[model samples]
Target: MEINLKNIFIAFLKISTILLGGGYVIIPIAQSELVEKRNWVTKEEILDYYSIAQCLGGIIAVNMAILIGCKLKGTKGALTSVLGMSLPPFLIIVLIANLIEKIVQIPNIDSFFWGVNLAVVILIYLAVKEVFLYALKDILSVFWFVLILVLACLKVNPVVLILSSLAFGLILARFKKEVKDE
Candidate 1:
């Protein structure tokens, strides 16, 4: 089925509305809506796109939305999905910023935010578990995970790490191809 801009817009609206902890929390929701319900991409494909989104220089949620949109309908779909995903949060932040000074004085608002934080923690935990379960598919992947984790702990710049990982992967692929041809 052909994807319309309206469809992409609506999909992002649904995804963005329920999202509290940001892009990471969107995984389960995206899996259900985009993969299972809409069949825009498979579980594995979405995960791959999520990884790619993470390595790039933008908000993961926007990147994921664009990747999924592009997968579904190309350039127009990508722009439409980004527009859909961004507007709600932008508007929300604007509204929230306007109210922050007054709202911070209320005890109940603090409690509400604390509750939201707890919920976000849980959602993030589930998303991480799901990602690890799928991502650690082999010894090589495990090795890379450890290496990346260590790098992160050492305070390596994320952009540097991403570029290094890309270079490493390309070199490994090239070496493997050459070895196979030998």
Candidate 2:
């Protein structure tokens, strides 16, 4: 199948419809669909896109879709992807807004949401596991991993953590290069 704007839109639209629990949940589903099933992108590319998406401002799935779409077909692909990703949630929110009062009154809804939350937790765990395995390739990475986990537990803001990690990673890379040259 050709990787065109229409396909990109449809893929994201289908993904957005089934996606729950936001960005973390997108990982496995996207990997299965875009990488394994469609062959539109690679696993490594998805991982890289996911990592970059985390640093960006908007939603993770949408950011990822844009990056992949742009890589595949440029600006039109990106626009199409965003439209696909956004449309479902927009409509769902509008529908919910109209029925929220009645929806809240349903006794079984609490149970339903609780089950969904549990599933989301599992999805998040899977996403973290995939990223963790990809990231911790060496002793230095492990060191940074521990350090970052500590900082996160200490309640440091995520933006600060990411920025500091970027700075330190650059410095370490430069230092490694200089040492190798010697």
Candidate 3:
């Protein structure tokens, strides 16, 4: 099915507006909308876009929306999706920034934010699990996950950690290909 630019923009607007917690909260929603509802992208493609987004420097959701849009309907889709995703939040934050600061000073508001924070953590965990299930298909991927987790826990520089992991994965993949060719 041909995905229209208007539909892509509307999808981003809906996701950005309704998703309560943050980027993490948007994952399942995006997956359901893009993969299940619209059938614009597959689950595996979404996961791949997510991985690429993470490895690059930017907001994951915006990057993902742009990538998915570009994949579907080229440059126009990318621009509309990004605008849809960004404009509402930017305007709302600007309007409410002062009010939010004042509200944050209130005890109940603090508690509310705390709850939201916890929900964000849970959302991230679930999103990560979903991504892992989609992306990690073999023992080598599992090993790389463990290695990165350990390194991150040890406070390793993230850039180095990511580069090293990529290098290791490439080397292992190359070695596997050679062995298969023999």
Candidate 4:
């Protein structure tokens, strides 16, 4: 049951390479590998890491790599994991940059990318649903969701919406406590 640094790096490398979509697609794979398969962390802990990553100003995959690496192997682990996760994508993008314009110009290649884009959209939607399921378990969460949806549809800044939701949650929690005391 001992997890080593090399294994951790390989796990992240595999995820980074095989994940077809962008950062969000990492969620399910991470949940499965870290929480379910490897038992390196719990579901709640994974969600917490995800939330922290989202709040921070960087890519979720890199943030997650650091989080998981630190959790398993300390600072060195975090560094290696981040490097392992980032290097492949960086190199791939660089290698593809020259060919991308021509590649997209091809009808069959365009069609393939379009299909892949659609699949990525679906994957992102499923990931959002899974993440929300962890938090939206009560009436308050539903109310907050409705509020956020309304605000988002109206083109409000997401930062404002998030802050407003936090304030609303605090107020609701206080009200719930007061009602219980009465």
Candidate 5:
């Protein structure tokens, strides 16, 4: 598998320049650029990365950077992508940090952020819809999806949900095999 660190850096840099809002908002953007445009990874692959990102508990975009970067060009690629995605934001944050308190009081700033937040919500929704469509590949998957959705709505612990899903899948696979062999 050939991978170029430069391309990885360039792609992530382009992505970061336009990114805004919470890290979750990066999902659709990353999908558009990495999976759809660059074809560096598949939709499923990126979704998997996103899921892993959730489990890992850092900024979603940064976790995604590491995953996509490693997938594209190993460790060096990961480093390049991380730097590309982080550098500008880091600089901007440093510049803004001292002034953020004052900026928050600016007229219409709250409303502007409110609009941006709504757009980010839409972006996150679209990304989840795409991932759900891809993941609903079979009856078993559908069952788990619905089950997890209900459990999540009920506020079940995520760790338990993950474990339950793993058990369900494993049992289903075994049952299918047993029936097939009979």
Candidate 6:
């Protein structure tokens, strides 16, 4: 299907509307919608965009929308994607801000939040599983994954982890090319 501005906007708007928890929860939904259903993007493409998005400053979901939008259309697509991705959340936050205190006082609200938290955890697990499987495609990748996981657990800065991973990947690629040419 030819993805146009309207489709881009609507897709992101829908994603943003039901998006609870954080950016990690977005992975499976985006994969299903854009990759499986719409056929607008590939699994690898979404994963690549998502990885890059995480390394950047802003919200990961919005970063994803911008990257995918730019890929599909261009500057206008990026703007439209941002508007779609942000509008619902902004309005919802505004509405919730006023009523959050009272809303929490209601009976069963605690249970509701508890359930939502559990669901978010499951979603996060699914997202992590997907990315982990995608990333560990080789022995070298597996080595890097374990090393990085250890570094992350030890509280190493994410920027250092990312840069070092990039450097490692480049050197590995260069070595592979030189070996292949021999």
Task: Look at candidate 6 and tell me the lDDT of residue 111.
Answer: 91
Which portions of model 5 miss their true places by more than 4 Å? 1-3, 166-182
User: Per-residue lDDT for 99 in model 4?
Assistant: 96
lDDT per model vs. reference: 0.82, 0.83, 0.78, 0.77, 0.82, 0.83
TM-score of each: 0.82, 0.87, 0.81, 0.78, 0.81, 0.85
Q: Tens digits of per-residue lDDT for model 3 on 69-144?
A: 8998789989989988997899999998879868667778767877988887877776677677655666766777
Which prediction has more favorable lDDT, 1 or 2?
2
Lowest summed-lDDT stretch of 10 residues in model 6? 173-182
lDDT, candidate 4, equals 0.77
lDDT for each residue of candidate 6 in 1-182, tens digit (9 for 90 to 100): 56999998998898888687667777888887788888988777888898889878877888999998999899999999899999998898888998988988999988988898889888877767766767777676788789988999999998899888778768888777642210
For candidate 4, give the lDDT of residue 28.
74
Candidate 3, run of 10 with poorest lDDT: 173-182
lDDT measured at residue 65 in model 2 versus the true structure, 0 to 100: 87
For candidate 1, list the clashing residue pairs, or say none: none
List, residue by residue over 65-171, the lDDT tens digit for candidate 4: 89989989999899888888987889999999999878778778767877877887777666667667667777766787887898899999977876776677578
* All candidates in order of lDDT, best leading: 6, 2, 5, 1, 3, 4
The residue pairs found clashing in candidate 3 are none
Error of 4 at 72 (Å): 1.9
Better of 2 and 3 by lDDT: 2
Count clashing residue pairs in model 2.
Answer: 0
Give the runs in model 3 whose Cα sits over 4 Å from its true position: 18-22, 173-182
**Which portions of model 1 show Cα errors greater than 4 Å?**
153-155, 178-182
Clashes of each: 0, 0, 0, 0, 0, 0
Q: What lDDT does model 1 reach?
A: 0.82
lDDT of 6: 0.83
